[model samples]
Target: MARLRDRLTSLSQPRYLAWRALPLGSFDPRFARLRIRTLVMEWHRTRETPDDKAWCEQTLEALGHEVTPGIWSGEVNGLLWARPRESEARR
Candidate 1:
């Protein structure tokens, strides 16, 4: 995920694919529904409304993720990555 963080920062527009191929019995059940890319997109799509923002943030937190809108960042467990901000892109 360190590489993911670096790629997100360096690329003008970086995209990611969530890891979902783990064996059903190989890991914790909590991670069964954690599709990282989907989570980020859902956040980006619904960040406009206050209710939606709260819900998404809460959901991410419940999944043991840390989300930072200011940095366009999201961390899954310990893995971390970020998207470039609109302001930064214009600069």
Candidate 2:
């Protein structure tokens, strides 16, 4: 069971550095504005219940992204989100 958990956890790990027309180390400020959604549900290995989904959604909102019901290309293709800082929530 532990091995399974570890494997599942690793599934959410970042596989590649770039996709979605995003480049490697481009340093483009425009891409900086994009909000990336995180798969917080992946934190637990058992399951993704409604409460878990809500928690993920709320967490994303707290992060300031207008997250939808589906995973973003960033989360799907790559294991990264150029997430904005918490300071942005104050503005």
Candidate 3:
């Protein structure tokens, strides 16, 4: 698809493979929200700071997400709710 082609052209990398495999809806406008917005797979990479990874958990709490060892769930911006599980510890 054009989107995939565009993405590949912009930056080719292994990480992009996993990113591309995500559901189409995952790219919805919500994912592009301002800093401190909702995130999916990568907690560290989603933090507000451009190069910082420590804000993930703090931001998640602010958004009402509860994190356990391998699971997390809650509403983001009070508009969306999610419950995802991590297969590996500390992922």
How many clashing pairs per prediction, in order? 0, 0, 0
Between 1 and 2, whose TM-score is larger? Answer: 1
Could you tell me which 10 consecutive residues in candidate 1 have the lowest summed lDDT?
Answer: 75-84
Residue-wise C-alpha lDDT for candidate 1, range 8-35, written one tens digit per residue: 7766432333223343213335443444
After superposition, the stretches of candidate 1 with alpha carbons farther than 4 Å from their true spots are 1-32, 35-39, 42-50, 70-91
TM-score-better candidate, 1 vs 3: 1
Q: TM-score ranking from best to worst?
A: 1, 2, 3
Candidate with top TM-score is: 1
Q: Across residues 18-86, which tens digit of lDDT does each residue of candidate 2 receive? A: 222334323234333444433222321123232433444455555465445534323322122323455
List the pairs of residues colliding in candidate 2.
Answer: none
Model 3, 1-91: lDDT tens digits are 9999998787765433232244532332342232332245443232333422224444444434543322442333112222332332123
Q: Of models 1 and 3, which has the larger lDDT?
A: 1
Cα shift from native, residue 16, model 2 (Å): 8.9
Q: What 10-residue stretch in candidate 2 is worst by lDDT?
A: 39-48
What is the lDDT of every predicted structure here?
Answer: 0.42, 0.40, 0.37
- TM-scores of all predicted structures: 0.30, 0.29, 0.26
